[model samples]
Target: MTSRALDELPSRNPTGAFRATDRADPYWGGMFATGISDGWVSASQHRRATPEQKRWSGVPASFVTDPADALAQMRTNRHRPSILGALGAVASWRTITREQLAAITGSAVMARTYPKSLSAPFSAGLLAHGHVSAGMNRLAPARDRMSMWAVGDQIDAYARYRKSLTFAEHVAVTGGQGWDAEHRFDRHNVLTTELALRVAEYCDVATVLGEKQMALPALLAAAGIEAAQADLGRKPDAGIVRRDGLVIAVETTASVGRGFRGKVAKWAQILQRHPTYELPLVVLVVDASTPSQATSAAAKNTTTAEIQAAIREAVRDYPGTALNRTADRIGMVPWPTWFPAPHEATAGFLDLTASFLARGHGRDEGWRQMRLLDPGEMPYREGTTAAGETIATNARLLAATPHWLRTGTVPRTDQYLVDQASASDIEVLSSPRVPDRMTGPGFTQSVAGRKWRHMIRLDRTHRESAA
Candidate 1:
């Protein structure tokens, strides 16, 4: 208790209350975190505003008074009923319709239209009437706009209707070809046009029978027109054949390679399974080519005639069963029989094939044909002529070739070596070419002249390698 002891005793701590510290309870801490003025007066004022005033006023009066405090209160009561809610309640009736809401929201608006004299239960009818009457005044272009909107709706309905058809029904409507559906060709303008016409007919029938029609006839007609444009020249060759509650159409195209042959083989197998249905596949080879001296010049040195003869001979040896039974059942028609002259043999063949597949016959009936072939100049060069110009010549050669050969045919002839006439000039033939005494030429030249020369050389080389 001496003077020394008093000096040593710690002075009363005065800064303890001002020391930085964290609160254990966040709720109470948050309450203390805000400024007293912002926490109390500003927050309370915002909570007191009328809903109508808040709704009508762009910037709320509460926020205008104390922005910071009002903001805090607004954040806290974001989900709660406020002046905006009250205003909405007062204007609820006005916003009931989609158009009314759109007007307020400044959104895209949709409305109905009808004849000027027509009346209906909804305000939509009144709007329609007003639109029609206001040609030069307030509602000018209203009917045109309405028609456009109606077209959009019609397209949507047609899509929905197409989607709603049963698989069998879809096949029947698309002329029974699976490729049409697989490739979406059935949705072409031609097909759509046909469907639209059918839909229009249905509407007519509905009207006659006093039935309610959901889609407009005008819309269907438009779709039909589009379909017609898209399916130009292309047509279904096979007719619809119904069996076991299923409808299928025969489809055919000139055999190109193993891929097409495989398709044919598969069809043949399927026909075996459903013999009662008859073969629905057909093959047509059309010649669409112009005889050109340039083409003759290009092919002059080539053994095109010999090759064609060999191919014809090979096809003649193929089993008759290889031909699609459906072709025979449906009646095979030559390309020239169905198409007019001046047609490329190849194009005419393909067209006839497609037509046969679409109509199941060679004769071009009234049914429209849709052309899916690319509309450009042909690229193949037969002789000196462009392939397009010589399509008829090449097509005839192709048609004479057997399906197996066409599908399996691979060019074994080395074009580069063939381009050079003299065997001595060909470097690739040095080791493989063997001289022939009878031909009075080198082995390579003599061997090259033989039938299936490339295949023979290839086989010989393989044999030598094995030994």
Candidate 2:
């Protein structure tokens, strides 16, 4: 086979199915096709000790050894985006099943030719399959079917690809405890990663920082402050940063059970000191109700009033000013549990976020009332019917428009808004030249506006203090 053809192998294979080119070939023993490694040692098992070219028998001579290099080489390949999505998901979720990874990345076929594959030796060992120990359960099946996983050390090359060693550094900072929970599946972290992935479809994946990536101590060190100044309390589940210096901290919750107050208390701590971290807005993403939360009328399944009351109770002993600041700077939005988000769900959250942003900027009347409509193109909005039940899932953001104010309406698909903003000189908010549009003194004198202004003023104070 030609060298170029070997490299294109991954793109040719179908998602979730890896196979050899010719069944008659001696090396083509239907190994990968049946999900058996055939006792082949993975590159990760080698720990970079052996020469990959020699070790990876039957692998393409041109297949990259570094995961970053592997992804870089696949720039023109159809699966590059899916590969990136996989890497990003791993960075947050840490330990995910192969099925989940396939769903998140939208591809399972990483290897094309017999023994030559992007999922193994060619990619600097981006992922590893390991024992899913069901401790002391002798009755457990002989094999763990969901074996594929991405560990912090295994995927470091992707961090190198992003040219941000900080991503890898924090993984070490936590002693990689996040991945240590091998036996139990952390639905919360997995769900959070899913949310981040969904949000990333709209913005730069690099800009969507997961909580594990935003370790407080590491952040303080990067900002030139002593790590000791900050306690490793609760941090945002994810952070979305705009080029215009707007940072939205996201906190997600799936349960409102007995421990709900404790979670709120932790959140209050972060919100109370948000200015120190330069986090101006904290968005609470309430996932669909669990059985317990749904049945409990008092818990109220993630309503704004319920969360606000919890926040008030958490900081009741604090000064009135602090209480007000905490309440004003925080906003609660329902995370669309509906299959594809309802048009109103998307519009409501965006308008709320925009309204918060429009507080200080006078010319942002357009932004305050900004809205996003589905245009009937969203595949998941209408949902699917199966087993005589209609199911609505969650909404995923498609394109990011940092300059939505100037653009009028933002499109919810890929490349349209991002490319339009970059290719044209349409006074984009992403550029520093549009500072006045981002910062000024003119908003409605409504009580809500005044409250937002108050929150911004305090945010400014905290940022200045940190500086």
Clashing pairs in 2: 16-108, 16-109, 338-392, 338-393, 339-392, 339-393
What tens digits encode model 1's per-residue C-alpha lDDT throughout 78-180?
3111211111211111111122211111222222232211111111110101111111222334334211000111112223333433222222122122111
Off by over 4 Å in 1: 1-237, 240-255, 277-334, 342-467
lDDT of 2 by residue, 1-467 (tens): 01222223332223222222211111111112222222233454444445664453333334436655555554433343344344444545554444445434334442112223335323555544332232222233434222334443443444444332122222222323242222123334444554444343332222355565455565445446554433565456666543332345666554445476666665556556544234333445444333334446655544534554555565553212432344434444434322122111232432223222232235312212222111121111212233001000001111111111111222122123334435323322222210010111110111001111111122444445534
Candidate number with greatest lDDT:
2
Instruction: Judge candidate 1 at residue 163 and give its lDDT.
Output: 42
Clashes of each: 52, 6
TM-scores of the candidates are: 0.20, 0.42
**Which residue window of length 10 is worst by lDDT in model 2?**
387-396
